[model samples]
Every structure is written in C-alpha cells, then in structure tokens.
Target: MSESTPFRAAAAGRPVAISIRNVSQRFGDAGSPNEVVAVDDMSLDVRRGEFVCLLGPSGCGKSTLLNIVGGLFPATDGVVMVGDKPVKGPLPRDISFVFQESTLFPWYTIRENFDVAFKFQNVAKSEWASRTKQALEAVNMGAFIDHYPNQLSVGMRQRVNLARGIALGTDIILMDEPFAALDEQTRMVLGEDLSELLAKTGKTIVFVTHSLAEAVFLSDRIFVMTARPGRIKSIIEVDEPHPRSPDFMLTPKFSELRNQAYALLRDEVRQAIALAREAEAAHA
Candidate 1:
C-alpha cells in the first residue's frame, strides 16, 4: 500500500474535510514516451478547520495535488472527496481558490469583479452587494471597491483576490502560493491577516508554499514531499494557535520547527536538482 493510507487511517476519527485517496496525476498517456507522473499514489485527509501546507522543492507536485482537490480536473488515478461526496468537477459552493496572481478582470471595478464571482456561484443577486462589501472589508480593501485591478498595487490586488475567494462563501479555500510575488515584508503581513481570517472564519485551507518561515508560521501541519512524482516524505506539526502574532516568529519553537522542515526537505531538493539535470541532458 502507499504511504498516505496509514496517515489517513490514523486521522479517521477526526472530522475529515477533504480526503484524497491514492491519487496520481500524469501529464501524458500511460506508457507514452512523453508521460510524466507529477504525483504518485498520494493519500491524506485534511481535517475540518485545519490549515495544511504542502511544502517541497520547486518541481514537486504540490500545486497539482491542490488542483485535483479543487476539481480543476480529475486525477489520473484514485479519488478525492470533499466531505463524503466524490469530486467530479468544481464545487464552487464548497471550494474556492486564491491563485498566485490576481484573477480579477482588468476592466471591472472591484465590486463588479466580485459580482461576477457571485453570479457564477449562483449566489442571489440581492445578497451580492452586502457580501462583496463584507468580504472586501475583511481584507481591508473596502474603500477601493470602485478601483480597477490596474489601479491597485500588486499587494492590494492580491488582497482583493483573497476577498473574492472568501466572499464566495465556500467552506474550503485552496491557495496556490497566493503571496509568492510579494516582497517578504508584505508576505509576512498578509500571512498575519490570513491567520486572523482563519481564526475568525474556521475555513479548511490547503496552501502550497515554498517559504519555510511562511509555512512554519501559518500552518497547523506541513506535508513535506519527495523530489518529484511527489509523495509525502514526512508531516511536521506546529502546535501554535491561530491569529498568530509576529512574536510567535521570535520563539525558540518556531526556529526548531523551521529547522526540522528544512532538514527534511534538503535532501529531496538536491534530488530534484539532479533529476532536472538528467532530464535536460536526455533532451539535449
């Protein structure tokens, strides 16, 4: 059996919010020369209200696994469950995504962008204005409702993107390196805001991030993966509570956990580099 089964079994007693069972994703037809197995035989359960981080080297399939969970597409093998239901396609009401870059329409005002999202989600027209206002306010972007995406700074645009996800009223949020493009300072501040939002909303979140400090500070647990054909290498737990402050980062425990995650990842990252080099030489 695969590594994930044991972990899933261990967490069976908890209220699982997302369950992935032996999922694998391949980029090409099976046995084809171009076939690339991005994820291999992975299984794990995300518990209700938990913040889980998928952390690994650059080419590992962290984001791919997240996409499967969000029903962006079906996995090549195995199944994913959101609660007890199988995910056949996007469950807009139950799941939302905040991507690395802002997905806001360039021509629309911030309010119009949210209206579009709600409309797609089949949210009632009467509730659009109130929900949009509340979500924007939550991200401290309420005053910019009339602004276009181009009018906002990169960080502000991301904040709006996050608000759009939140306003969708989904119970689960999948974030694909949402703060990736920001400077370190802005990323940290947004991390704080996300932590606070998590505490307030109790949403089940699955985040993909490469930053060790960001993972250590924001996650309830971190899933460290292997070099490629990514599988869980180890799981690291952070016992801190949410709405975490900057002071938490200064703690000895923070340093210890961060070091633990790094140590687990170091060899895998080296392996990934070697694999990349081999692939390059083969193509050449």
Candidate 2:
C-alpha cells in the first residue's frame, strides 16, 4: 500500500518498548554475483501494547525483518533494541513468534503441544497447566485441548498456534503472516479475536500481512513498504482504538484507507516486476 506522506504517531507519550535502528539484512557475501539484499536500512519504533502491521509487495522482506527483530536471525547492519537492551538472539522472556504454518508437532495433542512450548521456554511445571488453560480459553479452543493437530482443520490448527504464542506471556510478539493461509471469513473472525485479545493483554505486536483489509483491521498503524530491498515507504494510521469491530470495515473511512494503501502498493509492485525482469536478463 502507498502513502504520499509518512505520519509518525505524534506524542501519544507511550514508552518505546522496541527500537529498531537502520536495520538491513543481506544473504551471501557482499558484491557477490549471487548475493541478495533483502532489506534496506529500515528503522522504526514499536511502543508498548501497540499492534503494527508491515504491508508491502511480495518479496519485500517483511518476514526477514520480523526474524531479525525476533533475533531468530542476525541483521547484516544496524540494531534492534528491546527496551534498553540490544537483541542479540531469541529473547524468549520478552518476545515470542507465530508463523504462517502450524508449528505444533502432529503427534502432540493440543494441550501437549503447549506443554512442550512451555518446557522449552522453561516455565515452571506448575504454571503450564494454568497458562495453557487460560490461553486456550481465550481463543475459544479450550474444548479441543485433547485433539491432535492433524485432526483439526487448518483454521483450528492456526487458532491453536495463536493461543500458544499468547500463552508464552511475552510482552512483544513478532508474527509473520500467521493468518495468510486462511479463507477470508476465517481470517476476519480471527482478526476480530486478535483485536479483542490485544485489548485484554496489551502486548506489543509487529504483524506481517499481505492482506490490505487485514492490515487495516488489526493494526494500530500500518507500515507500508517499498519493493524488494524493502524500506518503509509510508506509515498509515488507522486512528481507531483496539477491539475494532467488523462494522468498522463497512465505514467510509475504512474504504478510503484501504484504497489509499492499495494505491501506494500498485506502483511498487510494477517497479518490483521491472527489476525482476532486469535481473533475469542480466543472468540470462
């Protein structure tokens, strides 16, 4: 999506919980013929309890940026700070991640999968049951706690995945298109659930999504990005408080914002295509 002007949230006065400065990511060696730069020098701050969406054209390194912030991988340049500390590796206590695919092991029951995650995070054995119960209940998946991952539909499996991430009790969550695979109706329902959950828990979330409507629905502010070697193209503000309803989508304001984001993205997608063709010609 596109915006002509960048609007940084002015003086809401919330403390910055995560500070990302001039972050860039590259694969392979510098200047090598095969080298690919996925992220340019992009920087932004995510405040406590805010939900920020990264929206951009395909291959724009949205997931790459998420991994860097989560410390699942290192950046080629710049730095990410969680609170006052620099992110060097997975910060399990402060950050958690949810992926597009179901991360639950097929053999494990829904309850058991959560137990495994809790064990890895080294939560006390006593807290696992209570935490697991609470998280499942929040997503309305409590009844299926005994079901195996494969037994559930894709939507249900994803719901369990979301519950597991929230159950981890991290103050910050980095999600890489967690709802991308779902059908529109399922995604909308889950988006509603997420908004409500965010209101209750007040965790900071950096969500990556390709859906313009989804971005508008769930984010406090959307970070529209450039093409490959992605950087912030513009930041679009929703100006709505969380626990947003489906009714919001039917409003005039929502349509305007959706069109605006789509307009911004259209040119970037064309540019990305042209660049791809040039690279192909060079290699050919």
lDDT of 2 at 129: 90
Residue-by-residue lDDT tens digits, candidate 2, 1-284: 22223444431357888888989999989999878889999888888888999999888889999999999989999999999999999998899899999899999899999999988877889899999999999878999999999999999899899999999998998899999889999899999999998888888999999899999999888899999889998888888887899999999999999999999999998888888898899989
Model 1 bad stretches (over 4 Å):
1-14
Q: What TM-score goes with each of the models?
A: 0.95, 0.94
Give the 10-residue window scoring lowest on summed lDDT in candidate 1. Answer: 3-12
Number of the top candidate by lDDT?
Answer: 1
The stretch of ten residues in a row with the least summed lDDT in candidate 2 is: 2-11
The C-alpha lDDT values of all candidates are 0.90, 0.89
Total colliding residue pairs, candidate 2: 2
Off by over 4 Å in 2: 1-11, 279-284
Q: What is the lDDT, from 0 to 100, of the residue 106 in candidate 1?
A: 98
- Tens digit per residue, CA lDDT, model 1, 176-263: 9999989999899889989998888889899999999999999988899999989998888787888899999999999999999999
